[model samples]
Target chain A: MSLLSVRSLRVTYGGIEAVRGIDLDVAEGELVALIGANGAGKTTTLKALSGMVRPAGGRVTYKGIDVTGMASHHLIRQGIALVPEGRGVFARLTVEENLAMGAYTRNDPPGVSADLDRVFELFPRLSERRAQVAGTLSGGEQQMLAIGRAMMSRPRLMLLDEPSMGLAPLMVQKIFEVIQSISAQGVTILLVEQNALLALEAANRGYVMESGAITMEDAASALLESPQVREAYLGQ
Target chain B: MDIFLQQIINGLTLGSVYAIVALGYTMVYGIVQLINFAHGEVVMVGAMVALWVITALAGSGTTLPPLVIVLIGTLCAIPACMAVGYAMERIAYRPLRNAPRLAPLITAIGISIILQHLAMLIWSRNPLAFPQIISNPVFHLGGATISGVQIAIISLSLLMMAALTLLVYRTKLGVAMRATSENPEIAGLMGIDVNRVISITFVIGAALAAVAGVMVGTYYGIAHYTMGALLGMKAFSAAVLGGIGNLAGAMLGGMLLGVVEALGTGYIGNLTDLCHVSWISSDLAERCAVDGHVILFGSNYQDVFAFVVLILVLVFRPSGLLGERVSDRA
Candidate 1:
């Protein structure tokens, strides 16, 4: 059984449906990527899975239990964390405080501390400026803090929404490397990104979404070589 | 020198009261971002309730001590004001949260008016005098006249401000409050109940304002339905004068504004014809030629001076004395 299963997830904003009956599943310890253009419902799918957006109709099953409309924070406690788009760091809080806030639900003091050290190790820049307010950080540093914060939650499934968005090319590579390292440590990753080439290269499996529906699903290797995906998204 | 000392003490006493009341305005604005115009009415409610406590004790005829009665009054007023605050948030403000921001503001104004009338209808527009024993206690300090009421007001205000500062900075609730103020949606995603935090913020702010109300009532020996209007406006100005969302800034602004007003009144308003009109138009070297003195203004214009300072402060430093940068989230 897959560690997470989202079946026929449908989310609407007023009369407009953002995610239209999409089905996706994340196996335990698997690296899956969802790639799409702007407004292609990639974000909507992540939000539905994290319970930030209530699905109008569908089932979000994590570890065989249906958790469709659970509150987002409650889901975080249950081991799912979503690093929201636009790098939603608490701009006023220091980097350390931001990390502490992410671990709010966890009371295991030693484990949380160890995880903090680990995050700092992974993103040494965050450790260097641990006392700095997140808002003042450069785009790359803020993205690192955002990802590090989600890691502090010790999530079983990390839903990353465009971790590479607005990042320098080198920083983009670094972020993907971190994603790879995180997945290698038995943490399942469901990465949503517009950087189709990098995301597919880093991911084992890929799903291409267009206008609120998944139009293609294939192994990352197949999607990389496909003429249609290349002509449409990779800007061949 | 003695008179100056006395005025300074008096300013400190009054400044403490404004500091306490200003905190309520600041905290409510900090979390919910609502001006909560009905907050002044919460103070009026406190005074009325305290009056009732005094009356109940006195009517019982010698069983409960006066201090016990005062405590009872405080307890009654705190909860009463808190309930009113919670109701205001839940009923009047919560429904309009998603509506235009101006809608809640208008509703807040309407609530303020309703509360004023409600105070009049219940308290009958007659200002109730606080008990004589509590109101008239006096102490002489080194040629400076200090009253027991003033001491209590000062001490109580300090204690409340200290407690509020601790609550904002030290506790888990405080952490949640800061988070809510910073970003409600993100705070919610982290398991903090944003709505409940906001409601609690209003309740706590209202409760503190109630404490200020009771103190003002006891110190002045009178509680009137309309008492909160001017005080509320002043407290609101104090909040803005000190960066509104900054808690420490509110206290600092309140005390500073109080002292400035006192100095202006003491030196400027009370001075009669001390300013020779020739001095106004003359250089320092030519000032000796002035003959007649002209009165610029009168002490009754204290409120106008306060507003003038307020305008100057606004013009120069639009963010207030303490600058706290706000993120444009909503």
Candidate 2:
């Protein structure tokens, strides 16, 4: 059974279908990448899965429980966490407060404190600026805070959307390394990115989406080697 | 000097009530941009409910203490207003969340009217005397005097404001509310129920409104259906003056508006008396005469000062004194 499964999930904005009947699966502890062009419904799929947007059609089952159209907060408690694009850190809140909000549903104070310390350990830069408002942080630092905030949920499955966007090459490398390390620690991840080369490198398996549909699915290396993928996404 | 001190004390007491009411207006407006015009009516409902409870308790001739009776009445008002606030959000505004912005604004006015009429039907159209349930002992402070009710109103309002500050900045719910206010969709991504946060904001504001209701009724010695209309407008003005979306702004706006209106009403006749225009007709000049002035407008024009200040604020500083919080774009 997959840790996260999407079967023919469809999401529409007004009249236009953003995510049209897409099927996706991420096995437990597996790092899967969903790579596509902009406007290919990658973000919409994640939105529907996290219940940010109501699905126009389809079903989503997480950990064998059908969670289609469940609200985001409930999904979050069910151990599904999404680090949204554009680094959706609470800009007005301090870095520390932003991280505390991540563990909003948890009641175990000691466990939450432990997780906070772990997040600080993972992103030492965040630790130094814990008192500063997130809006004041540099782009790379905000991205780091967003990821670290998600980690505070102690999620079983993580959905990361374009963590590399608007970041420098060095920061992107650092973010991907963190992604791989988090995956190595036995967290199932569904990574959506425009940078297919980097995404495929970090992923165990990969699916290529084009025009709201999955056009290719294979092992990460196989997708990397495919001439079509190399032309369309790899920019080679 | 004594008059000035007394007016200041009076202004502060009134300011406390305005601040409490303004919080409701600013908080709901802050989160969803809905003015929640019905919020004032909730304050009225709170006062009316308290009066009804007090009237009933007195009619039964129970041996309960006067303070205990007033306390019970106040306790009843809180939940009643909270329910009113909740229903306004859930039924009147929530369904129209995605509708045109004008729809909610218009709906708020409609709800305000409906609540006013409902109160008229439930209670009386004319002002009813709010019983003097407490022995309001006046205490001298410097040259100014502070009554027991005034002290209670000021202290209670300050306490609520402090609690609100703690709630907004200190609690998990507070962070969630701020996040929702900043970006509802992203807050949802962070596992916040934006709708719930908005509802809670309305409820908290309503609770404050209820307390203000009791305070106003006690202060004025009357519980009238229309009282909330003017009071609500003044509070709204205060919120705008303090920068509508900022919590501290609402508090500051409210207190300032109250004090300004009080002082304006207290001295407007005298201030107008100072204006000596020699060229004016004797009849009109008498109204603004140099020495022996005809009292053109006295404290009876208390309501006018709030609107005048409001006009001045809108014309010069539309963002408000604290400046409208430029929260990041959703």
Candidate 3:
């Protein structure tokens, strides 16, 4: 059974439909990439899944429960976490505080502390700047902190939105490696990205989204070779 | 020199009161970006509740110690004001949270008016003299006399501010609050209950307002429905003066404003009286010469100083003295 399955899910913003009856699935432990151009309703879809925005229509089931339109905090408590677009780290808070906030729902102090150390282990640069205010960090460092902070939640499924957005090539490479490492640790991931090739290469499977609907879905390598995807997304 | 010392002491006492009240404004503003114009009314509510409790207690002829009666009064006031504050958020402000920014502001003013009237109806329009039941011993140092009331206000304000600072920077809930203030949606994604944080913010702010209310009433020996209007405005100005969302800035702004007002009042008469304004008008100059003084303004204009500093701060540094660089982003 799929860990997360969506049936004809629709999302609207200000009377305009952003996600149009899109069906998708992510089985447990699989890395799924939702790739699309800008304004392809990718972010909105993630927003709906994470309960940031109310779904205008349809059903979203996680682990066989109909969890449509749950509050963000409720979804988060059920082991779902979103690294929102633009890396929304609390700017004025220190890096340590940011990570601590990620574990706000957890009451097990020792376990949370352990998870925090694990996050620090994964991102040494974040460990070095743990005491620094998040606002002062560079864009790359902020993205790293954002991911590390999300990891502190010890989520079962992680939704990443454009982790590579606005980062240098080297930084993007570093981030993708960290993401693949996270997936290897048995946490399911649904990565949304504008960078088609990068997302597809890191993903186990891929879906092509355009104009608020899914156009195609295939193995990551198959999507990489598709003529339509090559002409439109891969810049061939 | 003695006068200078005395004025400084007076200023410290007054500034601490302003600081305490200003924290309420800043904390609520920081979490929810609402000025909460009715916050002063919450202070008024605190004072009124304290007055009611003390009056009832004192009249009942209970054997409770004087200090115990005062403490009971404060205990009663804190929860009452907190309830008032929470209701204001849940009923008036929360419904308008996503409405146009101007909507909440107008609603704030409406709540302020409503609260003032409600207080008037409950407490009667006449000012109630807050009973000074406990014995207070005054202290003297360096030719300046500091009353026990002044000492209590200053020390209590300092203690509260310190505790608040520790709470915000150290605790789990504090981090959740900071997160929610920064981004409510993202904070919710981390399983932090944003609404609960906001409600708690209002409650904490109201608690501080309660203490400040009691302090203001005790210092002046009276409580009136209208007292909160000017006090609230002054505290709001102090919050803005210290950078609205920054905690430390609010405290600094409060103390500085207090000192400035005190010093301005102390010297405005002296400076204006000695001035020879021949350029203003020949008649005025002649009058000054005949009377040997201008005597333009005095302690009655002390309220003018707070507004003047506010205008000057707005004109020169609108972001406030400690306003952070908000442009930093990912």
Candidate 4:
């Protein structure tokens, strides 16, 4: 059985249908990438799965429990964390406060402390600037803080949306490395990226989304080698 | 010098009242961005209730201890105002949360009107007299005359403000409030019940307003139905002067406004009269000055000061004295 499964998920904003009947499954410890161009409903898909946007149709099941229409807060407690698009860091808050906010639902004080240490260890840059307000951080540091914040939640399944949206090439590489490291630590990852080449390279499995639907799915390596995927998304 | 000292004390005590009420406005605005027009009514209700309770005690021809009267009045106001505040948030504010911002503003205005009339209905149009126990003793400090009521009101209000600061900065609820204010969606995702937090904020704010109401009642020796309107407008000005969402700014703004009002009454009075003499064809500047009555912006200038401060703050520094830089629309 898949660790997380989303079936026939449809999300609509007003009359515009953004994500139309998309199904996905991620096995335990799998690094699954959802790659598409802008407006292809990549962010909407991740949002639906994390309960940020209530699905208009179908179910999102995590470890066999349907979380459709469940409050996003409840889903977080159930161990699904989404590092939202644009890296929504609280600008007024310190990096430390942002991390503590991620652990807001957790009651185990020692575990929260342990997770904070781990996040700092994962991104030493964050530790150095933990006292600084997040708004003052460079874009790359904010992205790292966003990911670090998600990590602080100790999610069983982590959803990352456009983690490399506005980063230097070196920073993008660093972010992918962090994603890989997070996956290695036994957390399932669902990464959405517009940078298809980098995302497909980093992911174990890749799903190609287009116009609010899953157009293709295969092993990341196979998609990287596929003529259609390479021509359309990989910019080959 | 003695007169100057006297005016300063008067200013400080009055300013203390404005500051206390302004803190409530700032706290509510900080988290919810709702003007909470009913907030002033909350103050009015508190004062009226305290007055009625005091009057009842006094009407029986048995005098309660001064300390006990003050204490009961204060204690009664806090919980009563808190309940009203919580009910307002839950019934009126919460349902309109997802609605357009203007909807809540309109609702709050409506609530304010309701509360004003509610106070009038309960207390009648007459000004309720405070028990004379509050003004029993007048202490002389150097050359300035200081009353016990003034000292209690000023010191107690400051104590409440300090306690509020501590609660906001140090407690778990404060953390939750900060989180909700920063980002409600993210805060909810973190299991901070956003609505519950908002309600708690209202309760806390109202409790502070009640404390202010009790203080104002004791010091002024009267409570009237229309009192909240003037106090509300002044507190709102204080909130703006301090920067709307900034907590410490509200307190500062309140005290500053109090001082300014006192100084205006004392020194600026003659200066402003000079303006009246120089600039105005008595008809024009007088019209623009406070009320159109007698002197010093006529006698109604006090009512206009709050609004003048509000306009000036908005025009000069839109972000306020301590601006919270909100995220710009992408």
lDDT of each: 0.84, 0.90, 0.91, 0.85
**Residue pairs whose backbone atoms clash in candidate 1:** none
Cα TM-score of candidate 4: 0.92
Task: Place model 2 in a CAPRI quality band.
Answer: medium
Candidate 2 per-residue lDDT, tens place, B1-330, comes to: 478888888999999999999999988887997787778899999999999998899779899999999999999999999999999999989999999888998999999999999999989789999988889998898887889999899999999999999999998999899988888887876778888999999999999999899999999899999888889999999988898888899899988988898889889888765345544676666555545665568778889988998999888888888864543322
What digit string (tens of lDDT, one per residue) describes model 3 on residues A57-102?
A: 9999999999999999999888899998999998989999999988
Kindly indicate the candidate among 3 and 4 with the higher lDDT. Answer: 3
Q: Whose DockQ is higher: candidate 1's or candidate 3's?
A: 3
- Residue by residue across A1-236, what tens digits does model 1's lDDT show? 99999889999999899999999988999999999999999998888887777899988899888899998868888899888899888898788888888888888999999999999999999999999989899999999988998898899999999999898999999999999999999999999999999999999999999999999999999999999899998999
DockQ list for all candidates: 0.53, 0.75, 0.87, 0.53
TM-score: the better of candidates 1 and 2: 2
Chain A of candidate 1 scores what in TM-score? 0.98
Worst 10 residues of 2 chain A by lDDT: A11-20
Task: Write the residue-wise lDDT of candidate 4 on B1-330 in tens digits.
Answer: 476788788878988888888888878888888888788889988887777677676667766776677678668878999999999999998898878888999999899998888888888888887666654478898788988778887898889888988887776678778888888887776667788889999999899888888878777778888888889889888878988888888888898888777766666555555444536476656665765433445434666666777899878887778776542311
Score chain B of each candidate by TM-score: 0.89, 0.94, 0.94, 0.89
Candidate 1 lDDT for residue A208: 95
Q: Estimate each model's TM-score.
A: 0.90, 0.96, 0.96, 0.92
**Predicted candidate 4 versus true structure: per-residue lDDT over A1-236, tens digit per residue:** 99999899899999899999999999999999999889999999988877778889988889899888888888888999989999988887889888888888888999999999999998999999999999999999999999998888899999999999889999999999999999999999999999999999989999999999999999999999999998998778
lDDT of 3 by residue, B159-238 (tens): 99999999998898888888898989888998988999999999999999998988888889999999999999888889
- The regions of model 1 sitting more than 4 angstroms off are B62-65, B135-143, B272-298, B325-330
